[model samples]
Target: MSSERKKPDIQYVNTDTKELVNLLIQGYESIANKRLYPADPLRLFILWVADIMVQQRVLIDYSAKQNIPRFAEGKYLDNLVEFLNNTIKRLPPQAATTRIRYTLSTKRETATVIPKGSRSTVDGKIFFETTKDLVIPIGETAGDIEAVCTVVGEIGNGFLPGQISKIVDFVPYLEKIENLTATAGGADTESDDSLYSRYREALSTYSTAGPEGAYRFYAKTANASIADVKTVSPTPGVAEIRVLMKDGRLPEEETIKAIEKLLSAEDIRPLTDKVVVKAADKVGYKIDISYYGFKHGQLSAEGIEKAAKFAVEKYKAWQSEKMGRDINPSKLNQMLMEEGIKRVEIRQPQFKEVSDTAVAIAESANLINGGVEDE
Candidate 1:
């Protein structure tokens, strides 16, 4: 979930315990027509009562904040989104899916059947099952079938081609099973931040004229894993929507098609607009940098080296997470310095501009630690 946007702190009422106690004591003195000392029984009773009032005030503030979208969380946030005019709802977790190829030992004389729900695995801990039955025709040794993860969410994502080759269910004449495409589209339950962002964009959906924010809202609603979207109109009546998945992964073909279908609906788009949906293009860059630490710094030389390596990884993640972010070595240098590095030399990625429809990705990384030197 995106944390770049900060929520403002809001409170409905004052909840200062000390101030509440003083107020209570003052009221008691005014009503009783006498001063109440600190050690007196009445003063102690007032203090106890003041504590309870403070707790209630704090709860009042919390409950009031839940009614606001920017401060809501959990089920409260879900309810807040539903309050939108378009009946927006929180997105649920989705499973990763890919195509698995079943190879027969030899060409079948008649036909070979791979039943629906046949399971395959890479490490045996997680499983992917065929979505439908597959029939291999005569003279064909293989057939490809769509498979979905048994468990939901991102745990089943990123399994590369040929990685899941082990078949759990026995299929007659099956020689091997392998995934043909990388698993994609797995995502956890929608986070509060992401849902709120969508809720804001959903405000534009009330317009039948099809605004840019309206298209962006529909594109993001297509998949839970979608992190960023850019909408552009290069020509009159032509609307192009670019989608970027979470963690810098490009959207799969299935995701693109889903977005296209949603945006092209008569109720969603204007009559004159031609809607197109596609994955955001990638701008590849490499990370090659050397960092040094101060000799008199708090950490030892070994500690500084470890910290510098971690900083590089963090910088790479930060740079790639957002669409249209430039390839900037200066950000890497700043991160390294923040991690106690005395100096840094970034030699690979110079500052390069990236278009709104493209994302900057680190193709590879090589970080060198130059040990410690005088500050």
Candidate 2:
């Protein structure tokens, strides 16, 4: 039932991309009569070769020249980073946010209006600022407001929006500020290498039917971030959209409403269908793993535990309410052993069939070292 609607990781692709310097050096070495070395003549020849390549503009269909081969001004080396980032998804940085609750100060009877762009900081490392002005009328000064990141990055994530314990940013002029929900969507910009590895991902996206495809609309239009989505039709004309939020955390009310609005839009959702948006129902299961090789030094016990954790994480992402999707311990065992894990046995979670409406969630997996029995 979990359908993805986001950009998939780019696939690995090696193109016949060439560098001017490398090509020039190779050509010089190939010429037996030429002894190219660090000299004015050598420099000139290298510059000429680089200029020729630059003028030729011989690059992959998608490749762009970043630096021109010129010693003047500075060594303009190729900066593929910008080209790579723009070529595919913009690879946007996270938008920081916090839900604020403001109240009219009893001391001042007059309504206090704090203009938009009011700033707040957390330990000087990160800052959250009000997106719009906070207006507390003559009779009322207490209310909730939203503060978004002044900049983009992961530094602004993880705190609850409704955290009342601390008020990091506020002036004496404004009413007391209180947080209402934890900030969850603040994510670091994806790494260049990761984006580079997914070069093919930028070339083509899954059809709107792909798991990532279902999430694209909300991500694009609603500005909502979701972890997993299951698109299903329990019956005809009824589209059951269940989403698993990031890190198993529930989304903000505003986020959920925005998703509903977008999914129910005539252009995005099926015109003939009735859409119901709900959080994915998680089914937790504990896996007891027993294997003989960990103690014998096949891999460190901690390493095996790490492998188990990674496997569980992957499984969680893949689980859904799709028809005929069920937990198979043997498959899990096989996946683990592929990383040098041998003699595996899954003692818990006897396999069973799950219907299309039920999502299988692996809450935890217990690793038993050297086949130790758990009481």
Candidate 3:
């Protein structure tokens, strides 16, 4: 269930709120680009929700007097909910997933199972617990039983409405500050007086204080990161490195040609899954989390070597491809994005054509045009 209600038109929102939303959208675009995924929809969904949960959790922990652990062992789902509520304090479920059917049957009279803190155990009755305590009728169908068990107990009690709302509100503020900072820069070189210096100072103050003062302070200097230089990281056994510039700022022809030259000669295996990119507003640094799946490994040197080897081969190939010895970045980028990653960060890369630069160059063309847009 999404809490994404259609908000009123921009005219209805005050200037500040509207500004914040734009900034947030940009941040989302930046983050979505660096993350890579395995070709698993369910896993992708999980990662998406997890990222949101982690983002909110970290924000709350950073702001609060007493920090909370973002990850809870043995109760990932439960802890996720709790963290959301306690940190964000929002009403309704922040995220939800539905399973239409289970591979394992619930109607069996007897089945072997593993019990918590012990090995296999046998029990006459199958019992389950929920947040709320409720009575289960005997001889009830599994579907009916599930309905009866809608006990709203403390499963994710820690996630409350108020906390979540606050966290949700905080993101826009961070974005607003960035936008404001960009507005401050002047055209003249002498006027270029350190956007970086002012940005750091504003960020430090924002960290200690709230978004109120910083929003006004940084608004004038806010500019986006432009694609200038692209960094490709390949550790052994990992996936190849490829990114695309969606914003029109980059010269598509030359960039594509450079990337294509690399991919042709490289030993890099084509990556089918997509990548996810995230940007930190204050630091202006991008963090990309790419996914590569390998067979389960044993706790042995051989297992470690296998993983390492895979990463090395893949990375070297990607590097070679990136170098124009194997494939072009544009083609590799297109293939990877098509496979599902569909998201990438242009990472304020240097445009040899325009010589213009910013923290990031994002494409809004997809936003109004519909269809999945590159983030």
lDDT of 2 at 329: 75
lDDT of each: 0.86, 0.56, 0.26
Best by TM-score: 1
**Clash total of candidate 1:** 0
Ranking by TM-score: 1, 2, 3
Question: Model 2 over residues 24-136: C-alpha lDDT tens digits?
Answer: 76777688556567675885778776776564554421233223111101111213334443434424566757777766557466767766876665556566777888777
Clash totals for all models, in order? Answer: 0, 34, 90
* lDDT of prediction 3: 0.26
TM-scores, each model vs. reference: 0.83, 0.59, 0.14
Q: Which one wins by lDDT: 1 or 2?
A: 1
Candidates 1 and 2, the one with greater TM-score: 1
TM-score of 3: 0.14
Residue 169 accuracy (lDDT) in model 2: 50
Residue 137 lDDT, candidate 1, scale 0-100: 98
Clashes of 2: 34
